[model samples]
Target: MNFPLHRSSAPLAHLTPALWRRANRHLLAKAIAEFSHELLLAPQAVSRGEGWALYRLETPQSEYRFPARRLALDHWLIDAARIERRVGDAPAEPDALAFIVECRDLLGLSQDVLPVYLDEISSTLYGAAFKLQRERLPAPALALADYQALESGMTEGHPVFVANNGRIGFSDRDYAAWAPECGKATPIIWLAATKRLAEFSHVDGLDHARLMREELGEGTVARFEAVLAAQGLDPADYWFLPVHPWQWHHRLAMAFAADLAEARLVFLGQSEDLYAPQQSVRTLYNLSRPDRRYVKTALSILNMGFMRGLSPYYMSGTPAINQWLHALIHNDATLCACGFDILREEAAIGYRQPYYEAALAGNGPHKKQLAALWRESPASRLGPGERLMTMAALLHIDADGLALLPSLIYASGLSTEAWLRRYLEAYLRPLLHCFYQYDLVFMPHGENLILILDRHMPARVLMKDIAEEIGLVDRANAPPGAMERIYTHVPDELRTLWLLTDVFDCFFRFLAAILHEQGHFPETLFWAEVAGCVQRYQADTPHLADKFARYDLFAPTFTRSCLNRLQLANNRQMVNLADPSQGLQFHGTLENPIARFRPGAA
Candidate 1:
């Protein structure tokens, strides 16, 4: 199957400023050309806007978007021209180009056609060689020679290329030019290959050709041969010219070649873009420092597994949070490495303490290590404020866990608000305020909470244990009374102060730590701004304190009222609360064993 491959001379735009600054002009031009070519053959039409060519494709099921760099090639070309003009030389545009091609939803099709398309286009558009005038072959190979002529003007050790035994070669001096940039010796080219020829060095001539043939395969060679045949050329007599080593590594050039190969054979199509995967959501959960560290470290071990992807499994009748958690863990190794250290410390502490006492008490060593770790290690050391804040965050989980824990506890089909209340009052509330005092805060989206659970409870501690510990569940599965009983027991003024100070303190502490680590002055200034906001809110709104007092007694109303007050105080920016709308779901399903409960059972 053949497809029309069109080349356009439209000026590129919207190159990411970051990339433009880092990439050279030749590289930028090549990247743009490749991107544009891919967009042209994309399943959906491409649109240029705000300095980017946004490729949009739609399958019968979903839409995909890809943004390719803009103005990159043009800028590079222009800069090169300017440099040439400054040196009183005429600008010469090379015929070589680069392109990028991407395929969408290849897995959804009965047969992927991307590889075939790529091969047809590449061999057609970029496979032909230029017929240089015989006299011009001695013109010192254009840019490389000119660049060499200006060697004295360049810094010492600058790269210089020379023709060696009819092949282009780089001197040690030339290799030096790239060393400072990449911190390594650059690979030097011994041959230069144009579209119609295969170049090789005398030192490794036959071996190199054999390797290339093996890599490209007879099928690819045939495709190249067919292209030349179409152009009425004899492949056997065609000379294999040497090309720059950098030319082969260029992303655009490689992409273009790959795309062509892909387009030529249905079996060689590109994979679907990961950035546009269907049924994907980034997951997060909160963690204590040590637990966070352990999770971060443990996550590195799962990178290969994550990249290969995992089948979705149900947890609580929803997709398992572990899948996304694993992905995050794999992505953030820095956080994980620290966690490993903390885990080792905890494990070492556990080895030295509590086992003898547990044995004397007739308890097995099953939990001896864990108990030791918890008791002796500073890694587990959490101040009152951190614990309280952590508890508060745990409450948010329990608020939802209640729906799942009863079924797990009793194996009953019945769902009961009674069981949920009993669990919340007896197990969850007592520890709610503890998190506040501990100055614990959830990560931005609360997705990091899973990491915390995975680290702490791991295997033995069930959700019920957590619920019971936090006072969400009563010992005998009895109701602890109304919401008032759960929250009203705490003094109104004290509750108000705790909530205000705890929330603000957690935010401030986290912001301060991150800012200080980043070494940013604005972060310090941000803390000052937060401090000023607190003072201004308190002083400007005399009713704020009274509102907090009222909300403490009317727990639900008070929580909302406090949130509203905080929002107003912060110029109407919404504050997060333990609310259902924050992607927190309470429904239980058949597959979730935790959601199955007996009637009248906790």
Candidate 2:
């Protein structure tokens, strides 16, 4: 089988000024819409007609007007073409950087944060331009595409956050070689580490040698061991770890110089199997053999609010968390009935540098610099005639202005309403059960989930990014020990906001808007379908009626926990997952779209 890998001499061919202007216009539109939703920049209503409205936002340096339709959850669906930017009565081109600089005070960006935030916005625009040039697949063709295609084809990063693809540390060459949107096949770098300094953990049925033998083939493992044996070192005392090639050259080479000099960390070269990075950036999928488990490595790059590194101390108990959660999900009839399952993190290995370990306080970048985890691939979970697609693709609109969601819905050969019903059941039903029945909540945003499409209709969904992202609202029920770190205590009034903000606002707000614009699917119909999913789930399980009422999904309003606000406040460490509600910036509340769909609502 021929892999779709290529080399290009002209990586920056996409950076034409024409594309730059177009990218900035699109980005400015996004900034306006998202910032408006967060209430950082209030756009006064200028006029209203039909469903859309004209609004004007006055900043100190500029007055901007854009046509936007206010959708459910205060979503400002702005039209990029009609947006007008003026500087003291003279029309000016809309540039995202200039817009940010002009509205820095309005955005509550401090003197230091403003410059760094602008850098992020620039990197995001750079990625957007690259995508505009190369991501050529139309939504209709993408409707029948495979999993990796859908993953890379996704144009929007995190739907709610404007500075989503700000890979701050990556250079232009690194972007070409490593960015998921580049669709390049990269080989994972393997390193042999002494067991004394490194920790290897896995589920019951697996061990280090077996994992190595399976992952790097027996021949390569033997070759690696022979290198160790040649150096007068015992291969038995060491464990093999997979790492991102970029991290090896960038962070490990210099930071872990002591380990390299002491022969504690031996770089064992690249593997024969090539892996393509997923949207999350750090996690890579094996293109050489699709059935192989994914390799998630620590990357020091600051992206989307945090330095993307896996904490060795925190990751040690990942397999245990997965083992517990997998059993819990399987034991329940409802989760199984919905065909919901998770891609388990089967094994993990983390190296602790003594110097950094002693010097660094708390879970800083130095402490989290060298670690990796292997998660089960969704390929093995596919049944006959089923294919995998990232839930993010549902919100993707290609450069041609064609949307993939409508394409998939149409390709399913079901009416819009019927297709949405199947989708809600596959993706949303299990989430409801997890919250109401078990008091569990996951960061079930689009990228954290995979949808199994049986000919374009979502059959079931697989949730990943586990162990780190999932939390138990009932903190008392958390498994004692390091695993208990997943405990997140939300106030009783704010429990439902987890679902409302994570699933509804973060994901569905954009999804409903796309459907309305691309497919003419009414926003009311979408919310109604969502309401039906919850009603059916509750009706089936009357035992959880009290819990459902207490944490009502159909509540009139929920706190607007802003994603960009967290990033704006501090991109380095956005929100402490251990204490999630702390330092949260909630301006006000958003009216829940499903409130009107309640049985007894006015």
Candidate 3:
């Protein structure tokens, strides 16, 4: 069997000997170092055999011996190159040289020209990574047209006929949007068919049709098989499919048993894809069973949260949901990591156009809303304080954040205000340290002092546009302190705007909307409270007040006056359900209980 070779610069031909030697030395040193770091054992005791590296580690957990193979090295090399490409430029330091060298070695290029190669790879990878992650291979031995038909049938409400060139043509009547009479037609059928195809292509050593009958009901399985028979196909030819739960429940069960059974002949609904080759058919079957409790538990572990719009109780009642949720969740992290690797590896190949197109295509209307919001409010407009507030707002809207919030709130039982205070305090206290360490100077209106004080008293002020504020702090302004102090604490990468755009802006907004829809007012209130705190901090800072007065920037309407206005608005909206737009105006002097004695309010 021929292993596919990745493309590299032609000049690599001249350096193949040197490259191999370098790779050997590098691999040996890397293996030893990894063994030492992970096992805490001397590298000398480690031994390498065909496709395996044996080493011993001392740990209370267990005496660990990791098995490493040459094949695994190949995979790792590919994965590392991909990661390096994704990360783009290496830090401009001697320590970063090893990373550059490793990337070069993977591509069979010399270290002398590594920087040039690295630049090429980074630009290429950044463009295509997101799209490639979504591409799924067709079931093995299934014709392209068949795959297209299968996918069309899954997504659209009708069975698709495949035309030449792998395009799926659906009758106008079958178009989901065009046909209204087919009330809530099962779309999962198509999803199931596609999954069956995927399994057939990817899995091994299984009777696909039998598994389908067992998983889907016998009647449905027979109909699916009949459809395949009519198409002049034998079921056994497709026996490599791996069963994924999403497809099985939504579409396969609804399809004719003949079609289902015939389709199953080529697919294995549940089996190892890339990992755990030794896993038995029975083990895979057990994991894929609709009744398995392990599915939700697995999903929670893998995705760092539960399925969206699904509850633990819901999972308990629905075996299909449970099974699919488990399969997806269990594979989530590994799939994510693999996708990242692919993006990195492919960067050098100059195929970013397709990747970017895929991302734009995949993101739905919700993402479109986020993109609009991002464009409407660029980070350049806000100062650090306001930017951080925006970040908080964005975080509140994130899907993962929203999904996990109810559980967290239920577990903590902290009132909305207290939760808001604690969360803001946790984020801001560290952020303040970052501000000081970065030596970011304040602007006019005492913004810096206000921000500092707000962090000190998180409950008092509200923070909006936090994302924008954080963006305003210049990298060069970072305090002259240990680099570790600045970089170590945050959960995700803080050095770039990608995290800001993707996680903070997009995902967070999604979370916030989900929470709002779910009637999780406490989460929203918590965000509002944080925003309020920030605003108050800016208002009360003595330096800010003095600067405003000295510069004649102070309006007759003071910071306290603004707070009073907001307080009145809140009370009118909450207590009497009064509209702020109505004739009743806040004179900024009403002694409402909520507004009274509130710092920075008159």
RMSD of 3: 27.5
- Kindly indicate the candidate among 2 and 3 with the higher TM-score: 2
lDDT of model number 2: 0.89
> Which candidate ranks first by TM-score, i.e. highest?
2
Model 1: residues >4 Å from true position, as ranges?
1-293, 297-418, 425-427, 435-602
In terms of lDDT, the poorest run of 10 residues in model 3 is 342-351
- Comparing candidate 1 with candidate 3, which one achieves the higher lDDT? 3
- Candidate 1 yields a Cα-based lDDT of 0.23
Candidate order, TM-score descending = 2, 3, 1
Model 2 CA deviation exceeding 4 Å by range: none
The per-model lDDT (C-alpha) reads 0.23, 0.89, 0.26
| Candidate 2 per-residue lDDT over residues 512-537, each given as its tens digit | 88888888898988899999999999
List the RMSD of every prediction in angstroms: 30.5, 1.1, 27.5
- lDDT per residue, candidate 3, 14-101, as tens digits? 2343334333233333332322222222422278765345544322222323343322101111111111112233322111234334
